[model samples]
Target chain A: MHDQPSLAELLQAVKHFIDETASPNLSGHPAFHARVASNVLATALRDLEVRTANESAEAASLKTLLAVSDGRSLDDMNRELCKRIQSGDLTATSHGLIAHLKATTIAQVKTDQPRYSGLKTAES
Target chain B: MQDFEAAAHRLFSKVFGAEADLSDINRLSGGASQETWALSGGHFEAILRRAPGGVRPTRPSAAIGLATEAALIRIAGKESLPVAKILHVLTPKDELGEGFVMSRVHGETIARPILRDETFAAARLKLPGECGAALAGIHKIATNTLPDLPSSNGSDQIAQYEDIYRGFDIPHPVFELALTWLKANQPAPIDPVLVHGDFRLGNLIVDEQGLAAILDWELAHLGDPREDLAWICVNSWRFGVTENRVGGFGQLEPMLQAYADAGGAVFSTQEIDWWEMLGTLKWGVMCMIMYEAFRSGADPSVERAAIGRRVSETEIDLINLLEAANA
Candidate 1:
C-alpha cells in the first residue's frame, strides 16, 4: 500500500548516507558516534525484515513449551513463562526449556547481532 | 582552554605549594558515573577522575567515594598493585569539586588494540599472568588499613542483583534462571577479601610490555576473591577472542596458576566457572539497567541503547553456560 522506496529501502539509504557521507567527513568522537548511529539504523532495518517471523516463531514455540491451551498475547505469555521460571514451576532441567531458550535467543541474536559468534556457532 | 588552564593553575597552587604550568590537557573517555581529564604541569603529570559538573552524585553500589578511591589507590600502590600513584585528593579549597589527581601512567585501555595489534603481541602473552599477579597484590591490601567498605558475600551480591533486576521490571527469563541457579548452587563462602569488582581489560592500561596500571576502582568491594578472578573472564570482557577467556589475552590456567604462585587464594576452576556465570548474568542485568536508563530518557544516548541490545548477547552466553552445565 505504501510507496516504491519501501521502509527497508529508506532505512538502507539513510544508513548508507551516514556510513558513506557523514562518517567519512567526521573524525574522533563524532565519527565514532556516527558509526554507532548507522549501526542502530541497520539493526532497525534487520528488525523490520525479521520481526514478524521471529515473533510468530517465538509465540508458537512458547505455546508449546508452556502447553498453553488458550490464546495469549506474546508479551503476556513471555511474562508468564518468566514468572514460571522464577517460581521454580519450570527450571533449567525442565524438558524443552533449553531448546526453547536457545531458539528464542538465537532469533534475537539474528536481528540484534546477526554476526555474533555465538549465533554462528549455534547455527553450525 | 584558558579558563581550564587558569583553574588548573589555581588548583595546583592550592593543592601543592607552587604554580603549575599545565599542558596537554585532554578529556579522556570516562564512564557515565565520572569524567577523566589528563594534564601535565611542568614536572607534574596527572589524571583527574571527577564527577560531572563538579558535584559528586550519589555513589552507586560498591563504589567508594572518590576521596576514598584516592586512598585506596594509595593503599594499592603501597602494596605494589599496579595502580597509578595518587598525588592529591581534592579539597573544597581546590575549587575543582569532588575528585583527586593521580600521576598519569600511560598505556592503552581499549581492548581491541591490546588483543590484536602486533605492537602488543608480547603484552598479550604476559597479560594473563600479570593480571593474575596484580589481582593477588590487590587482595593483599591489609583489611585494617582499608577505608570503610560495605562487606558482601555471595548471597548479599545476589540480593543486590535481584533488587536491580526487579527495579528494571523487564522480563528476562534467562536472568531469572541464572538467579535461581546461583541461589541453588551457592558456592561455600570463603573468607571475604578485597574484590576488584570490574577487573577487566577495558579498565587496564596495557602496553607492549604488559599491564601498566589497574584503573577504574569505582566498583571495588569486599567480597569473595574468586568474584574478582571470575569477573575478568566474563565473555563480555573477552571482546572477540572468546577462546582466551582471561580478558581475551590468555587461558584460565595460567592466570589461576599465577594467582596461586603470587600467594593469592587458590580456587578450583569449577568455582571460577560458577562465578563466571554470575558475572555474565550480572553484566546482562547491568545492560538491562542501561536500557531502562535509555528508555526513561535519563541518559538518552545511542551508546546506552546499543548496550541494551547486548543483553541478548548475554542471553545467548547464559544459554551456552546453562546448556554446558546441563550436558
Candidate 2:
C-alpha cells in the first residue's frame, strides 16, 4: 500500500497551497524555508528513531519521520520546506520524505470567486 | 449550468445505472471542503457534492474518510426549510469519489434574481418577514434533533462565532471590531433565534411560484434573530444591486414591514446596523481560512490559491463598513 507519495507529488502539494493560501507578503526565499522544513522533520525523525540518510534503500521503512512533527503549524512548516525543495536546497529523498509528505495536505483550499459559489443559490 | 463533461456523466451513469440521466450540472462552488454540482437527470435533477481536491479512502468519520454529505443532507432534510430532497446518498466505489443524489427543486438563488427576475421580484419583498419566522422555527427545534453537533456550542450568536473562529486558527481584526460593535449595540436581550449562518438573497432559492427555499446551512447556529435580519441585508449579498437593500435584490422597507407584520418587532436601525457590521466582520474572518489553507498546502487547487486574494478585498470593505456602522 502507498503510505505516502513521491517527492514530486509532495512538492506539488506545497506549491499548490502556497500559491493558493500563503499571504502575498510571505517574506524570504522559498529555498531557505524548504531547508528549514526538511531540517525540522529530519530532526524529528532522528529523535523518533526513524531513519538516517536519504539513500532510498533505508527510506521506505522510516514511517515515523513526520510522526514527531507535531504542534508546529503544519502549513507554515510545509510551505517553508517546499520552497526550499523548489529552490533545489533539500532533495525529496528517503529519510527526508516526511518533510516532503507533509509539505502537502494543507487546509481550506477554497475561493470566493463567483465561479466557486456561483452567483446562483440552490433551488428552493 | 456547465457540463462538468470530463468525468461527471461517466461517473453518474455508472452509479445510477438505469436511473441516471446527464443534464445541466452547474457548479454551486460555496465550499472549501466540498464541491456541489447542480445537475439534472431522469426523474431527478439536482446537486452532486463531492470532496474537494485529493482522493482518500472511504470511511465514516467527521471531516475525514467519507463525504459526510448524506449526513449533511439528512440534517438539512430534518430542518426542512426547503433544501433539495435527498434521493440518494452514495460513496461510489468508483467515479466522482463520494457524494449523494437528490431531486432538484426549481428556483433562482442568485441574490440579484430577487430584484431583477420578474419571477422573484414580488417574492423578494416578502422574504425578510418569512425569513425571520423561519429562523425562529430553526432555533426553537430541540437540540436532540442534531445529535452530531458538538454539545458545547452555546445557544447564542457570540458563542457560535467564537466556536467557528477557534475552529479555524486565524485572526480577523474586523471580527474583533464587529464583536465590539455587537456588544455595544446589544438589542435588549431578546430570545435567541436560529441564525442561518449563510442566509442571504444568494443563498436563497426562489421557485417559479416564488419564495422557494433556503440553502447552505453549514454555518447555521442559534443567535440573535436580528443577526439573521442583518445578515440578509449585508451588502455583500446585495450582489451590486444595492438599490434593493435587502440583499441588493429587494427594498428594506417592505421586507422589514413584512417581518413586523409577522410579529417580528422593529429592531432599531442603529442596532441592526451593528449586526450588519458583524456580518461583514465574520465573513472577513472566515475568508482568512482560505488564505491559511493555500499557504499550508493542505488542499492544493488553483481555485483555492486564487481565493487567497479575496481576503484583502473583503477586509478593506469590512473595515469601511465597520467605520460607517460605528459612525
Candidate 3:
C-alpha cells in the first residue's frame, strides 16, 4: 500500500504501537532492540495483511519484509518479545495472540495454510 | 566476595532496608540472561539476580526493555509454582543493573547431575512425565489474570518459530524443512494454553522431594499445550536419553499418557510427532543462535557454544524420526 518505512521510522511506529496498544508496567530494558522487534512485527503484520489481501506491491518485497529466516525464528523475535513482555509493552500471550490473529487472517484469505484432520489439537 | 557484594548491598538496601548486610556473595555459573549471585544478607538468605550488562540494554529492536524478568519471577511465585520468591525488584543505582532480589531454594538443576546423581537418578526417572504434568499446570495459568500480559492463541507459536528463523538472516535448511513438514502436517488448532516454552531438563530444578521447581520462564508464553508436550520430549533435551524418550526420563507414550492423566486432552501420536519434529527444528536453531551469540560475545559461555555443537546432532535425529514416522 506504501513504500516500506525505513527501519528508524518503523521503529518509531513500533513505539507508537506499544504506547497505544501494548500492556503497561512491562519491565523496561533493551529499549532499542525491543523497538526493533516491535518495528519488525508491526511492519510484518501490515505487510502480511496487505499481501494476503493481494495488495502487496510485489512478491520479492514480501519476502524481503518477512525475512524468510533460518535456524531460530524466535531467536530474534523472542529476544525482543522477552524485552517487550518484561517492559509491559506486550504480554507473553499477546505476541503469539497477535501473530495468530494476523497469520489466521492471512490463512483465511489465502486458504493456503494446512488443515489437519483427526489430530489431537484438532479435537480441542 | 566479588563486585556483587557492594552491588548486592546497594540492591538490598534499596529493596529490603539499609540494615541488610549481604555476605558470602559468589557468582554462580550458567545464566545467560542475568547476573546470578548466590549471596546471603547475613540474617536472611537470598539470590541477587541482576541485568547482565549493568545497563538497560536494548535488543536489536529499540523499543523493548531488559529488566522485565524480575517481575516474571514474582508472577511465577504467585502461580504457586516452586520458583524462587521475589523479594524486591530494584534498579541498579551505582553498579547493579535493574534486577529483582529473590529467596533462593536448594536443588540440583544441572542436567549432568540430574542424570548422574545416584541418589537422585530414580527421581530423575520420574521427571519426564512429571515435567509434562508441570507444564500442564503452567498452561493452566490464565492470561486474563496476569495484568499487562499479552494475549495469545494456539497458532501464535508458529510466528514465534518463524521469528527465530528470520533473525538468523539465513533460513536454516533444516528449519525450513521442518517448517515445511510442520505446515504440511499441521494439526488442528486447539484452545491455547500458557506454555513454558523451554520445558527442558536443564531448565528444571529438582530435589529428593521431586520436581521442586522449574526455572527460566524467560521463554514462557501462551501457545499450544502440545508444543510444550513436544518441547520436553525433543531429542536434544533428552541429552542422549532418547532411549528414555520422555525428556531422557521415560517413553513418549507414558509421558503423553501421564500428561493425559494430568488432564490434558489426548493427542494423536501424529500430532505429538509433528510437534516433536518442530521441537527439533526449534532447538536446533536455538543452539545455533547460542553458538553465534558466543562467537559474537553478545553472551560468552563455553557451555552455550558446546550446546550449539550438540544441537546439530539433533538434525540428524530429526531426519531419522521424520523418515521413520513417514514410513
- Number of the top lDDT candidate: 1
| Candidate No. with top DockQ | 1
- Candidate order by DockQ, decreasing, is 1, 2, 3
> Across residues B66-133, which tens digit of lDDT does each residue of candidate 3 receive?
34555555666786766877777665454666666677788877776776678787787677668667
Q: Please tell me which model should have the higher DockQ, number 1 or number 3.
A: 1
Task: Give one digit per residue, the lDDT tens place, for model 2 in B120-154.
Answer: 65676566556665655555565455434422112
Question: Once superposed on the true structure, which residue ranges of model 1 sit more than 4 Å away at CA?
Answer: A1-5, B1-5, B12-19, B41-44, B58-60
lDDT of 1 by residue, B64-168 (tens): 778888888889988877889888888877667899888789889999899999999999999989988988888877788888887887888889888998877
What 10-residue stretch in candidate 1 chain B is worst by lDDT?
B53-62
Give lDDT tens digits, candidate 2, residues A23-74.
3435433433443344333333332332222223222322244343434543
Colliding pairs, model 1: none
Ranked by TM-score from best down, the candidates are: 1, 3, 2
TM-score of the second chain, each candidate in turn, equals 0.94, 0.70, 0.84
lDDT of 3 at B204: 75
The top-ranked prediction according to TM-score is 1
C-alpha TM-scores of all predictions: 0.94, 0.56, 0.64
